[model samples]
Target: MKKLLTFSKQAVLIAVPISLVISIYVNSLVTILFLLVFLPDLIKNFKKNNFSKNRKVFFVFSAFVLVYLIGIAIDILYGTANFRKSERLLPFILFPLFLLFSDALTVFEDKKTPLKIFGIFVLCFNLFLLVNLFTQTVVEYNDNSLSNKRWKKSNIKILENSKERYALFPVSEIHIADVASRPDLLMERSFKFSRDTLITRSVYVKSNDDVWLLLRQFDGNRHEGAWFHPKTARVGFVQKNITADIQKLENGWSRISVTNRVAKKANRERLQITFVDENKQYDVKGNVEYQLYVGGTQLEIGDSPSDYMPLQHRNFLEGFDRTTILNVVEGHPTYYSLFILISVLIIILFFRSGYVQFLGLVLNLVMLVLLGSKAAILTFFILLFLVLCFNFKNRDSRLKLLYVVIPLSIIAILSFSNTLNRFNQSLSSVTEKNDVVYLSTDKRIEMWKSVIDLPLLNLVLGNGNRHGYELLESSTALTLNSHNQYLEAVLCSGFIGLILLLFFVVGIFFVDFSARNNQLLILFVVLVGFNLFFENLLNRQWGIVFVAFFLSYIYKLGEVNE
Candidate 1:
C-alpha cells in the first residue's frame, strides 16, 4: 500500500508539470487534466493536514484566489454575476489550493528536476513552432507568386497586406463613410491606366452635373499606372484589337467612351476597372452603354460595384511577422520565452557545468531574439549582469567579465539589427499613413484613459468579475479586458482586491529574497515584477500555473541549497 501510494504521488508530480507545458500549446484539455490528476494528491494532502505552519504562507497563497472569490461575491450582491468570468478565476483558486494542500513541493527531491524537465519540453515546443513558422512562410510565398502573376496579367493591383490598412481602406477612398456622404466634393475624378493598355477608373458625384471625364491607358503590361483628369475636353481613343463591355454599376454617376476600329469583330470583353485607394487596389466590372458615332462609339457607364478583393494576399518568407512563432504555440512568445529563460537560468545555477551553462545561455539568448520581446530582452540582460556580479568571487574576474561582455555584445548586435529593421519598416508605414506599428500602443492608451474615467463605485468595488468587457463596450466599443493586470485586478475587485494582490506578490518576493542569498530567486522576482507591469499575469491560465508552481517550489525549498 505504501509503495503504491508513493508511485501514485510520483506519477502525479511528473504529470502536473507535463500538463502545465501542454496547456501552453493546447487549450483547456491540460487544465482539465491538471485538476483531475491533482485531485488525488489534494485529497492525500488534506488527509495529511499539511497546511503551511507560517501564517504569511497561508495569506500569500490565498490572496489571489481570495480576491477572485470576493469579486464573485460582489457580483452576486450586485446582481451582475457571470459564470464564464468566474470560471476564469478557477486556475487561481485551484493552483494555489493544490500547492498549499498537496505534496507538489515535495514531488522532486532535487530542486532543479521539475524545471529541467519543463525547460526541455519548452525548448522542444519552441523549435516545433519555429519549424512550423518557416514551413508556412514557404507555402505562402509560392501561393503569393502565383496569385500575383494572375492579378498582374488581369491589370489588378494588390497593396501591402496589413490588417489595419485592409480595414481602413478597401477598394477605393470613395467607399469611406465620410467620402460617400458628399461624393461630389470628395470624389477623385480621375482615371488611371497601366502601360499594358489596361485602364481603371472610379467616379462619384452628388449630382450628374458634377461628373467629370478622366482617361488613361495601360502601357506595356506593367503593374504601375497613371491617372488623368481632362478639365476642358473629353479625350477619346480607338484601339484596333480591343472590345469594351461594362457589367454593372449602382448608386453612382459615371460615363465611359470606348472606340473600337475593328467594328466587324465585336468580341464581347468585359471592362475591368481597377480602383486604387491610398492603401489597397481592386478591380470592378461595369456596363458600358455604347452608341455609334461617326468614326467610333460613345459609352455611358452605369452602376458598377465590386467586393474589394486582394490581388496577392500571402505570407512572405523574407518579411514575416515575428509573432508568427507565437501563433504556432498559440500563446504570447514573450511570456513562454520568459518561462524557458527562467528555466535555463535555474539549470545554469544548479547544474554547475560551465559548458552546459554556456550552451543554455546561448539557446535562451537566441530564443529571446526570436521572441522579440523588448521587456524580456531587457530583463535577460539585467539577470545576466546580476548573475555575473554575484558569482564574480567564485570565478576568475577576467573569465566572468569575458563571459558577460562577449554574450552581451553578441545579443546587442543582433537585437540592434532587428530593432533597426523594424524601425525602418515602421517609418515606411508612417509615411504611408498606415499606423499598424502604433496600434497596440494607441489602444493601450485609450484603455488606460477609459479605465481612469470609470465611475467611483465601479472603481471602488471593481465593476465586478468580468466587468471589463462591459466597461470597454460602454466606453470604446471594444470587448477586451484591461491589458494591464494591475488595472485588471483593481477593475475586477477594487482597491481592496488590488491591495490583496500586491500583498501576495510583495510577500512572496520578500520571503524568497530574505530566506536566501540565491541569485536565481532574485532573478525570478525581477522577471515577475517586469511581467506584472505589462501583463495581468494572474488572469491567464499559464500565468497562474507558472506563479503557483514556482512559488510553491521556492517556498518549499526555502534556503535549502543556499
Candidate 2:
C-alpha cells in the first residue's frame, strides 16, 4: 500500500506541472481541469496527514481569503454583486487549488532547478507568443492564416468591440478653436470662396460600393477626403454617408470646420443619427449615444450627468492584445515576457549561488518596471535613494541613480512642454482640454478625497476590491482606485487584511534584507509599488500576472527529494 501510495504521488506530481504549464499558456478551461486533476491527492493527504507544521502559512493565507469573502458577503447583502466586483473573489476559488498544487510540488521535487526552469520556460513561452505578434508575417493575422483563424474564435468579441469604421476624408487632428474668424455662410455641402465665391456645390451622395470624395472651391482648387465606411449592414453600428456638403468656401477652402465638444454640460441623453432622403423619410438609423460626428471628426460620447450605464465599465483590455503586438513591433516596452522569464531565471541562478540580497533587489526592480505602475516606481525609487544614500556601498550607484532620475525627468519635461499637451489634444481631439498637462497628480488628489468620508473600518476593509467605485460613487472624480497600492490595501482588506498583506510584503523585504540582498528586494519593491499607482493591479491581467509571478517566487516551497 505504501509503494502504491508513493507511485500515486509520483505520477500525479509529474503531471501537475505539465498540466499547469499547459493550462496557463494554452486554454482557459485547462486551469479548472488542472486544478481538479490533483483532488484525489489532496483528499488522501488531508485524510492521512496532520497539517500542523505548515499551518501558519495556510492559516494566514486562509484568513486573508476569508475576510475578503465576508466583505463580499456584505456587498451582496447590499444588493451590489457586480461582475467586476464578484470576479475579485475569484482567488477564493483559486487558492485551495493552488495549495493542493503547492503540496504536490513540495512532495515530489528534489531539486530547486525545476522551479527555476519552469520560470524560464514561462518567460520563453510568453516571449514566443509576443514575438509571433511582432513579426505580423505570421498568417494568423491574415484572414487566410490557419493559426490566425483559430484565434478568431478567441477574439470574436474583442474584434467586434474594438471595431472602428474607416473614414473617406483624412481627418485633421484638432489643434484649437479659432473663435476669431466669422462663420462663412454657404448652402449645405456648398463651398463659398471669400464673401461671394461659390467654389463647389455640396453634393449628397450614397453608394453600395466604396468611393472617395473630393471637394473643389469656386477658385477651382481641390481638397480630397476618403469615405471610410461605404457599405452598411443593419447588424452592426457602422458609419454611413448620405450627403457631403462643402456649403461655404472662402478663397480655396471652406470656412467651416468640424469641432467636437468635450465639456458639454448638458444632462446626457442617448441620441441617434438618422439619414433622410429628399423625401424627408428616415433612410438609415444609428445610435449616436456612443458616437458623434463633429464636422469630419469622430468623438466618443461618454457618460454625462443624466445618461449613464452603471455597469458599462470601461474595457481597457478592448484592444490590449493587438496594441501590445503593435508595441512589441515598435520596440516600445523593449523587454517582452521572454525577457522577464529569462531575467527571473538568471535571478534564480543567483539564489543558488547564495547572492540572495542582490537577487531580491533585482527582482523588485524588474517586477516594478514590468507592472508599468508609475506611482509604485516613484515610491520605490524614493525609498531606494533614501536608503542607498544612508547605507550600502557607493560602488554601483550609477544604475540606481539613473533609475531614480529618468522617470522623474520625463515627468518634469512633459509637464513643462506645451508640445506634449498639443499632441494629446490632437490624438484625443478633446477640444475642451487645450493641452495635455500632467493630469495624474490631479486624479490622485480626487481619488483620495472620494474615500475620505468612509469610516475607518470601511476604509480598512476597502469596501471590497473595486468597491472603491461604489464607495466613491458620489465623487465628481468619475472613478475610484486609490491608484496607490498601500491605499488599495487599506481599502480592499479591512485593517486586518491590510496588516496581513503588509506582513506578506514586509516578509518579502525582510527575507531579502535579512539575506543581505538589497538588489532583488528593491527590484520587486519598485515594480509593484510603481504599478499600483496608475493601475488597480489586481483588476488588470498584467497586474495579475505580476502578482502571480511575485507570489510564486516569494512563496516557493523548499524542494524535496523523491
Candidate 3:
C-alpha cells in the first residue's frame, strides 16, 4: 500500500513539470490528485495548524485561485452548477494543496525535488519550442517558395508596376512582418533622380512571354529614359549616357537594371513603365512580373560602396530562416514573446553565461524581436537594463564594457529592421479607429477606458467569470478582452479579489525579505507584474500554468532558503 502511494506520488509529480506545455487535463488532474491525496489531510490541517512561511505563501496562492472557486460557488447557488469554466483553473488551488500535503506528510527529504524536476522540464520544453520552430520554418519556407505568390499575405497589397505585367513575381514572405515596409508602402512603381547624379532602376522579373520594356520620364514634355528588350538585351535611349544590366536569379527569375548616366541632363523625376512590344510580340495586358529596386547617386536612393558591403537591401538578417519561418506554438505572438522574455529571465537568474548562456540569451532576444509583441519587447529591454545595472558596481571593467555595448549594439542593428517601425507605431497616439494599426499601446489606452466605465456593481463584486466576460465584451466591443490582467482579474473576482491577487504576488517580496534574495525576487515580481499589465495571462491555460508554477516554485525556492 505504501509502495502504491509512492508510485502514484511520483506520477503526479511528473505531471506537474509537463503541465505547463501540454493539455489542460494534466493541469486540472493536479486537483483530482489533491482530492484523492490530501482532502482528509486538508480538513485536519484546517482544524489545527500553524502558518509557516511556506504555508502562508501557499494560502496567498490558493486565495487567488479560490476567488474564482468562490465565484463559481456564487455562480452555482444562483443557477445550475458549472465548474466547467473554472475547472481549468484547478491547478492553482490544487498544486499548492499538493505542496502543502507533501510538506505535511514529509514526502521527500528534499521538498524542492518536484520543483527542481519542473525546472529541468521547463528547459527541455523551451529547447523543444526552438527546435519545433526550426522545423516549422523549413516547411513554411518551402510553402512560401513553391506557392510562387506575387505579393505577401500581409496588408493585402497588390502588384503596382506595369513594366513586367505577365510574369509572376517571386513568392512573398508571409512569415513575419519582416517585409512590412516594402509592400505596405504607398510607393509608386517608379524611381526619382537628382540633377547631378546617376539614377538606377533594377527590376526582378519572371516572364510569361517575349516583351520589350520602355522606361520613360515625362517631366514637362522632356522625355528622357531608356527602352530595352528583356529577351534580346537590346536597348534604345531617348537621351545619351544611359546604361542597363541584367543578372539571373534563382528559379527562372532575372534582375534587370536600367541606369541613366547623365541625370543632370535628364532631371528624371517621374518614371513611366510601358512595354514597347505590347501588341507586336506580346499582348497589351502586360508580359512580365517583377519586384523593382532603384539605387545609384540619386537622392531618392544611394548605391553601396562595394558589392560585399552593399546597401541595406532587407530587414535585419532577412536572408535568415529564423525571421521568416517561425510562427509561435503558443496562443498569440504576444504570449510566445512573453514566454521568450521569461526564458531569458530564467537564464539570467539561474544559469551562468560563458558562451552557451550568452547564445541562449541572443536566441531569446532574436525570438523576442521576431515575435514582435511591443510590450514584451519593451519589457525585455527594460529588464535587461535594470538587471544589468542592479549589479553594475560589482562587475569588472571588461564585463562593464560588454554590458554597455550589448544593448546599444542590439538596438543599432534592430533599428534597421521593421522592429523600429513597430516601436514607432506603438508610440504613436491613436485618436480614431482608422489609426489603430495594431491595437497598439494607444488602443490599450482605449481599452482601459472601458475598465473605468465598468458598472459599479461589477466593479465591486464581479458578475462571475462567464457573466463578467460577457459584460466586459459589451463594454469593450472594440476588442476581445480588456487586454490587462489586473482589469480582467477585477472583472472576474471583483475589486476585493484584485486586492487578494495583489497581496498574493506582493507577499513574495516580504516572504524572504533580505539582501541575498531581494535582487532576483525583485526581477521575478516586477517582470511578472509588468507583463500582467499588458496581457490577460491569468485567463489562459499557458499563462495560468506559467504564473502558478513559476511564481509558487520560485517563491518557495526563496522561502526554503530562508
What lDDT would candidate 1 get against the real structure?
Answer: 0.50
Candidate 2, residues 1-562, lDDT tens digits: the string is 8667655555543433333434434323443454565566667777766755334444433333454565565566557655444454454345433552345454443534444555545454445544564354333222211122222221111122222222332211111122222111111111111222111122222233221222211111122211222223111121222113222322222212111232212111111222222122222222211111112211123222222121111332111222234232232221232234334433433344434424434444443343333344345446555455544565543335435444654554354322233234334433344232224444555566555666876875556544546666555435556765556656655676567655544444443333234444344545554455445555543344345433433343321221
Model 1 ranges with Cα > 4 A deviation:
1-8, 24-55, 76-78, 105-107, 135-140, 145-317, 396-438, 455-458, 509-518, 559-562
Q: Write the per-residue lDDT of candidate 1 for residues 124-225, one digit (tens) a residue.
A: 665677677667655542232213111122222223331221122222122221121111111110112212332223222111221222222222121122
Better of 1 and 2 by TM-score: 1
lDDT of 3 by residue, 273-298 (tens): 44434322211333323333221111
Q: Give the best candidate by TM-score.
A: 1
lDDT of 2 at 224: 24
Clash counts for all predictions: 21, 56, 4
Candidate order, TM-score descending: 1, 3, 2
Best by lDDT: 3
TM-score of each: 0.62, 0.49, 0.57
Q: Among all windows of ten consecutive residues in candidate 2, which has the lowest summed lDDT?
A: 183-192
lDDT computed for candidate 2: 0.37
Name the runs in model 3 displaced over 4 angstroms. Answer: 1-19, 22-51, 69-83, 100-331, 389-413, 429-443, 455-458, 510-518
Q: What shift in Å separates residue 247 of candidate 2 from its native position after superposition?
A: 6.5
